[model samples]
Target: MPELPEVEVVRAGLAPAVTGAVIVGVEVFEPRSLRRHDSASGHFADLLQSRGVLAAVRRGKFLWLPLDSGRALVVHLGMSGQVLLRSPGSDTDRHLRIRLQIEHPEHGELWVNFVDQRIFGSMAVDSMQPTRDGLTAGYSGLAGGATGADGLAGSGLGWSGLIPSQVAHIARDPLDPGFSAPLFLAALARKKTGIKRALLDQTLISGIGNIYADEALFEARVHYEQPADSLSPAKGRALLGAVRSILNRALAEGGTSFDAQYVNVNGQSGYFSHRLNTYGRQGLPCPRCGTLLVRQQFMNRSSHLCPRCQRLR
Candidate 1:
């Protein structure tokens, strides 16, 4: 599963070309790639053809392109999915499932290819809803978004402050400027579950997975099994700060790419995997304390940590 940093890289990559680009054609080589698409709403191809992309926005792991029609094309990159941008005559990407032929005023024609080896990823055309807070729906770098014909930074539609209806349930990610730390900390102080489980709760805090959760816990020196509400306010703040730091570092490094399945639009692998302090490093020596790290079966998955450094107490 692609986490925030990985998805953000894709979103940022798409923003430059897709903003204001008109969808000239939509090709679906694999219908399963649109499993999440609602047939009752409208035909996928028909709904998108000739529609202009407003902006590429994301909240948590969910990515969406707001169309001028006020509907959004929601994209979920389940495991083994990659969105690639390429020229018309370029070498075809393997496992290509869907391709959007878009024409931009200045950039001309380009292809946005949705490639997924496992077929778990999906694309859909969905309705939109106004955000409760009336804040911008998601992050588009719109504050510093792609420049347009008028030399403006963002689309008028981008400021609509509407999010895809299909993605309404996701909470804002830590990296989102609108994510409220005081509110999140207050909520964390009320959680009855384990800290790791709480972090994995998208409804609670979005964009965290087993990988980053482990890394953040290690950084905060907090045990995965520790209760969320058990942390004092200072400790909670410290943990949140650790998450931001780790995510920023991962973003700078282009996110963790364990395999070729995870790559940016240009198909380059992120090297953050090399900087991992914990996660998938079981039995390796913990960098901070020289203790042997361990992996424990957790919620049908696995958790990596330093038994000595990340003490449950």
Candidate 2:
């Protein structure tokens, strides 16, 4: 699955071409790609046609485009979903799931193709609502909060800006400009889970998965099994900083692409995988302390760490 940096790379790549472009037509090559909409594929295509894509936005791992009709076209790139911007007559991939023909007076004709080897990625039309701050509905202001009747909390009345309803409970990522370190530290002190487990909790802090969790822990020199509540405020802040720094660096490198499935909008693979420290480098030397890296199974997944540096005490 693509993490925050990977998704952000895609969002940035698609924004320039898709924003301000009107969807002249939508072709659903695979009906399962629109399964989340729960409507017929034809109706799904009709809802998006002729609507302008205001901007390509992402919150954590969820991506959406706020359309002219005040609804968002939510895109979930399940496992192998790739959104590619191709030339009008470009050769289509065998796994192309959905394709949108867009037109821009400035940029001319283009096609946005959603290709997925696995059917995990889905597109849906969802209602947009305001953030809890009541200031604006930009991605920066959106933060995770209580789950409401519709599964996300809000003012329950007229909204100001707009965000997809499904993303309401997703906490702001560390990269978000509105992210608060003090607030996150307070939340971290309240969790009874392990530090790595707490980091993976989307409700606590969004955009972190197992790969980045290990990297951040390696940087913070904290063990995965350390109790979350036991972390001091300083340590919590350091962990958050490590996360931000790591994410920023990965974003610069176009995110870590270990296989062909994860790629940029142009179908180019990321080189950050070569820069990874401990995610997939078990039995390798730890860059910091020269200790042998080890892997352990936790939550039915693998966790890599330097036992000498990240000892659980």
Worst 10 residues of 2 by lDDT: 141-150
lDDT digits (tens) for residues 132-246 of candidate 1: 7767778888653322322334544343477888888899899987799999999999998999999999988898888899999999999999999899899899999999998
Angstrom error at residue 193, model 1: 0.6
Predicted structure 2, TM vs. truth? 0.90
Strongest candidate by TM-score: 1
Whole-structure CA lDDT of model 1:
0.88
lDDT of 2 by residue, 207-265 (tens): 88888999999999999999999998888889999999998899889999999888999
Best by lDDT: 1
lDDT of 2: 0.82
Q: What is the TM-score of each candidate against the true structure?
A: 0.94, 0.90
Error of 1 at 69 (Å): 1.0
